[model samples]
Target: MSLKQQLKDAVAKQKKARDITREDIVKNAAAIQRSRQEQKDLSNRPH
Candidate 1:
């Protein structure tokens, strides 16, 4: 098997174990990004 195929298989196995859907990942990533952005904005505001 090629390296790409091996990686694909590993990812499939991990997804099955975690039962993580793409939407779940996207939602959590977006929420984290939003929080980080909010903190950065607050820190850069006029003192």
Candidate 2:
């Protein structure tokens, strides 16, 4: 679905019955955002 939903799903998947802290969610979100930006950059390359 949306990016927000994706992040929620990612966090949920990582939880796997463990407690998820705010910091964990923030880190996951940041990682996802960075990877997305990297993907965009790669696609924009002249290669």
Candidate 3:
């Protein structure tokens, strides 16, 4: 491929990787929040 095409492909790949990484971050944050809430709830419950 030409240099221009190669650059375009590289940029596209980078964008895709960034989007996937963003999604993973969001998912992990949500899971961590849920886990924290569960722990808090368990601690507050009567034993």
Name the candidate that leads on TM-score: 3
Candidate 3, residues 2-46, lDDT tens digits: the string is 999999999999999999999999999999999999999999999
Candidate 3 Cα errors over 4 Å, as ranges: none
TM per prediction: 0.53, 0.56, 0.97
TM-score of candidate 1 versus the correct structure, residues matched by position: 0.53
* Model 3: colliding residue pairs: none
Can you give the lDDT of residue 27 in candidate 2?
A: 92
Q: After superposition, how far is residue 29 of candidate 2 from its true place, in Å?
A: 0.2
RMSD of each: 7.8, 14.5, 0.4
- Writing each residue's lDDT as its tens digit, candidate 1 over 1-47 gives 99999999999999886766777888999999999999999999999
Q: List ranges where model 2 is wrong by over 4 Å.
A: 1-20
lDDT of 2 by residue, 2-46 (tens): 999999999888886456576788899999999999999999999
Full ranking by TM-score: 3, 2, 1
For candidate 3, the C-alpha RMSD (Å) to the true structure equals 0.4
Candidates sorted by lDDT, best first? 3, 1, 2
RMSD of 2: 14.5
Model 2 / residue 17 / CA error / Å: 12
Q: Which residue pairs in candidate 1 have backbone atoms (N, alpha carbon, C) closer than 3 angstroms, thus clashing?
A: none
Which runs of model 1 end up more than 4 angstroms from their true locations? 1-20
